[model samples]
Target: MEKWAFITGASGGIGSAISLMLAQKGYHLYLHYRKGHEEIEKIKVRCEQYGIHVVLIQADLTDLDELQNIGRTISRMPDVLVNNAGLTHYGLFTETRIEDVEQLYQINIRAPFLLAQMFTPSMVRRQFGRIINISSIWGMTGASCEVLYSMTKGALLSFTKALAKELAPSQVTVNAVVPGAIEGKLLQRQFSSEELGLITDEIPMGRLGKPEEVASLVWYLIQEDAAYITGQVISPNGGWYT
Candidate 1:
């Protein structure tokens, strides 16, 4: 039998890395993105070279209707679901708008919860599944300006723990990958050299993590040997927060 992995944000930093790694592992990919079709199409073409089916779907996760319509667009249900599409907000709490909070929750939390419903039933019937939510270090430690982002990721962490227990009996494993300071263009835009240096100084490893490193952990959790591991909030943060 063949396997399928549906990864939201597959055109992005960590998502694209995960997509490539899973495609290399021989799983057909459903690369989900809201925009960035040009970037996502490149992934589809590259994954196809690995001889696995690669399909692309465009859906704005913040919109519930579009999210619900995702199931109808896919060829079949996915064995692995990577809930990775999210946006980050950086501003003082006092300056944060109510609308920003709602939109953040819509993408980071509610979308994944709804997607679990969309895909889990097939796994329950087949008795196997892997669900990995891409979280953040701020979720664990809570950052100053990123209050809303922290709230969203913290919610994802809790969701992973509770859902793992509910799905474990059905042989479906759920976990969250908490990443810290991964190398991305967005990071450059978010922080200046001094700020980035200060951030790096705090990390014991003295550097940011690579997207491939996070993908490696997700790859391991979905394997047969990892069947026993569930309900974990695993972080690849270079010993930043133990």
Candidate 2:
């Protein structure tokens, strides 16, 4: 059977890597991006080199209407759904406004939860699916300045565990990938060179992780060989906060 995969936030570094990896694996892709058209286009060009069809879906995940409209935008139900789109707020908990909380909740938790609802029925009918939530190590260990981000990611972890059990009977696997200090645009945008340096020093591996490494783990989790690995939170953090 021809496989299809849907990845949210496919314009970003890690998402782009996962998109290319799935494309290389011969899956037709629906790459969702709220912005970063140029970046996403570049990824599409590269992914097409693998001889698979690629579709771009643009929607602001924070908007309920847009999120729901995603169902109508796809050609088919995805065999693999990677909930990788999220927003982060870095500040003291008291400094976080209601607007910040709402955005974080919508993108990080609500969007994924709704996407699961939109796609899981088809997966259940087919008795096969892979749902990978791209959570952060902060979700597990709780970062000081990113409290809201941590809460949302932590919710994803719990969602993964609960949904895995619910979907297990149908052989639809749900899992979370928790990465730490990945060398990506998000890190670059959020931290200074010196801060990143300090973070790297904390990691046992002494370097920020590569996007390809995380993508590789995601690819493995979606494979038939990994069917038994549901309800698991796998962290590829180079021993940071482990």
TM-score of each: 0.98, 0.99
Report model 1's TM-score to 2 decimal places.
0.98
Q: Give the alpha carbon lDDT tens digit for every residue of 1-242 in model 2.
A: 89999999999989999999999999999999998999999999999999999999999998899999999878799999999998988999999899999999999999999999999999999999999999999999898989999999999999999999999999999999998888987999998999999989989998999999999999999999999999999999998877
TM-score of 2: 0.99
> Which structure among the candidates has the greatest TM-score?
2
Residue 35 accuracy (lDDT) in model 1: 88
> How many clashes does the backbone of model 1 have?
0
- What is the C-alpha lDDT profile of model 1 across 96-122, one tens digit per residue? 999999999999999999999999999
Which clashing pairs does model 1 show?
Answer: none
Runs in model 1 deviating more than 4 A are none
